[model samples]
Target chain A: MKTVWTQKGFLIPAGALLIAILLPIFASEYALHIAVLVLLYAYLSTAWNVLGGYAGQHSLGHSLFLGIGAYTSTFLFTKIGLTPWVGMWIGALLAGLVGWFVGYLCFRYGLKGPYFALVTIAIAEAMVSLTNNINFIGGAMGLEVKWLGNSPLLMQFESKAGYYYIALVMLVIALWLVYWLSRQRFGYHLIAVRENEDAAEALGVDTLRVKIQASILSAFLTALGGTFFAQYFTYINPRNVFGEGPSIQILLFAIVGGLGTVWGPAVGALVLVPIAELARGWLGGSFAGAHLLLYGTVMVLVMLFMPKGIIGLYESIRQRLKRGSSAPEEERTPA
Target chain B: MSMLTVSNLSRYFGGLAAVVDMSFTVEKGEIVGLIGPNGAGKTTVFNMLSGFIPPTSGEIIYQGRRMNGLKPHQICELGVTRTFQVVQPFPDMTVLENTMIGAYVRHPNTTDAKRKALETLERVDLDAKADKLGRDLTLLELKRLEIGKALASEPDLLLLDEAAAGLKDTEIEDILTLIRQLNREGMTLLIVEHLMKVIMNLSHRIIVLDFGKMIAEGTPQEISQHPAVLEAYLGKDE
Candidate 1:
């Protein structure tokens, strides 16, 4: 608990945010677009980290909520002319309920580790199939938001800066939420459950309730990203929104950045997305999927060399540097 | 009339009975020792009392409330907490953070729980290593942390499973002193230990189990000479 004003650590984020706000003035539209994509992934991945990283419940099917958010808001906007700003909240609520139901079914029966991951993937796939057969919400073809040039009220923007700012604001809020939780009892309990469920239970932590709450929160926030995705792209098919690709992309950023840390996912997105986008831009004509190959290779290298992710690596390096500055405590021999 | 009362408790794994028709009552503020050889179901009984598993047929009444069917956390919330025979530390967390998890049961606020955990860590003589990660601790420190974690919850009754299982004689003596100090401070303890030195030195009353059945129950002195207890340990001469 040091207040934000007192802590020197707050400068990193503050500085980063300041840089992000001013970047639009000098940066090209392409860079801004990549920045928006980075922010969106960072937001979604941070939401994923609440359950996957902090609670040690790796969910690979978060696209279920993503699809829910995209479809809900899109359907409302397309069919009934409801504004997406209001519709996004409804999508978030629906995603939260589904999150609760999914969490209840999996955690109530003690499904954990790989089994829980499989169940989530299964559920998301089932949603994909269900959405495909349904006609009311455009089925497999998907819904498209009606184009309205420079319409702020409808969340459609003429320039990339509007979406960039929205994405930036969303990411900041999500990061702040995670930072706040990290200092709270819920965050501690989630880590406790992650470390050892039986030990946590013995310590009087309600593991099930903590985990379920994490699921609901993670799903709700991820659905918000889904709505943002729909608004930004103006088109979201079930395959793109609720498919395995989006789900994998979300968790990858969390994993690569740092599983449990507040800024890890954002850092992960910050580093990886630009590289992917740039590689595709530079090498697309010669090798269509070469950038993906590079991305996958980089991911493999990170997992092999930095399994705890970039944050863990940074922490260990800092610890070593600190130790180097002072005489370290003598290691006690085992009794 | 008792702090904890168990009646006709039994747990059968498939056709094999781990513990059967066992009953005991622990008075408040008393240090009770449960002793048995390996697979004698000492740990099984501890597991039942702490709500790690349910008994097949029986009742566990603690302070006038039935404990069966309740989750382990609920059991801990009701002023009962247990430590494992194998130490469990959150490896990624600092020692202070690990202890804080238990303090959080009573102190919901982070600052308040941290203060409480620090005090508990001091009580366990682990204050110096508060900043160390749980994974870096020595075995003796891990054991102390296990007890410190349970103590942080401020339990009315603490269940310690083999708290001194893998300690040197001097280390055992050190832990015995800690246990003695805890009892003197009016904390009730139910200990399951294979080491006679620990059980005899600490328990106010000792219960001996053989084949999951209570073979002897008495003060340490009386239980030492009890024939069934001797038979359970040394096996009938000739």
Candidate 2:
């Protein structure tokens, strides 16, 4: 019985991967642009899930790391003629260091729940203020990637297809990383820390260390999204990357999709992003505020009815169906 | 040889001294009972010993190594594990997974940890409900699962706080029997229990405390007869 469930679990994701890989083939250019937007949000949210979802540390200021990544790569590319491919790693490392610092400072003092969330917001807000006044990295004006036509090396391309494929590949890798995390010892320790800290400590989990590591990994992954954002859009400013708006948007997908599940954030982005795009495209001037209204309504309905998100709703239905199918067989064989 | 030696252990929460100048020693293999009236600091002692709270001034020597500066996980790695008075199970996880978190301390590999956790569940008589979520268990089952989780680390010494608290006669008896079976298998224990029957029946020696101070220490029979203990504990119990 367990083996059958396991086989189905593996096969479904494999089938979905195949479908996602072929989606671009039949998609219109405009549709593919929307697909890229979905993948980008999915990638960012999945990155946020390492700490915010699995470890239960809701960092409301994750845009701090995103901004760091964007500024780091953009500065390096514009100043030294360095490629973004190399600068991205350097940005990731810096973001990881900042993540470690922030995690240690907050967790060491036992800041948690709402206090931890507030600290992240404060730190991200501080970064935005600092960036606005700084003379380097284009200051308030922002940096635009030099558009050397069809130059893949500089992370600049002539078409949206190039950016779309890059975003797709990045999302796939992030998904694979999260999938691997769900099965490992570190993952279990992380979940344990989230469930109950004192109990996890009694059971020999170093909750502080686990939280720090998750923070660093989450920050590292989020920074990659930052670099991708700068490269794909060809422009990045303080408000676009480090602002409270994008920060909320990043966590929104994770919470609405289902917090802590491997594919839930991706699932959230897939459902919400396209609706947003299609709503705006179809309704344009006729319904100026229609998409926002629709989006807000869906969020409220999910929170009210499906508090555990869509994946949780699906899981309950699946369990009921399995039990329904197996009930009669058990009675006939034993009684 | 002493497995644990605590001297002058004290904890002050602001102006209030929760535990004061308390000292005790547990030999290599013995079940020691800690009994006291409410607010007598039994849980506070356990908290300090497990490294959850830093002692204001004291020394905790476990197997001849000073444990003052160690973290909770560090203490656990040294083969001393504890269970909370308030049963804490990872509510989202299954009983087996809850035990697996403890098993992961010694067995870093997932498959090996799962195997150990399964064995622990069987020992605690919870194998039948191993797949049930932690929050779904009855109070008796939750207590047993708590013990199973602590036992999964294969600790040389275990500290149990109120393991049999708030239970029926049969449920307490079931827990008492499980503790006895574990001790017979060579697990040493330092248990803080409220039930007189549980402490007096199982302890080789008993320590009695009142208002954060130890009033008596001796064999269970001697402790039951001590005048200070009588006034401090039995008076409060009645």
Compute the interface RMSD for each candidate structure.
0.5, 0.6
State residue A25's C-alpha deviation in candidate 2, in Å. Answer: 1.5
Off by over 4 Å in 2: A1-6, A329-335, B236-238
CAPRI quality of model 2: high
**Error of model 2, residue A114, in angstroms:** 1.0
DockQ of each: 0.92, 0.88
lDDT, model 1: 0.94
Per-residue C-alpha lDDT of model 1 across residues A191-262, encoded as one tens digit per residue: 999999999999999999999999999999999999999999999887999899999999999999999999
Where is the poorest 10-residue window by lDDT in model 1 chain A? A326-335
Model 1 per-residue lDDT at A141: 93
Model 1 misplacement above 4 A: A328-335
Query: Tens digit of lDDT per residue, candidate 1, span B112-144?
Result: 999999999998899999999999999999999
Shift in Å, residue A284, candidate 1: 1.8
Clashing pairs in 2: none
- TM-scores of all models? 0.98, 0.96
- Candidate 2 C-alpha error for residue B99, in Å: 0.6
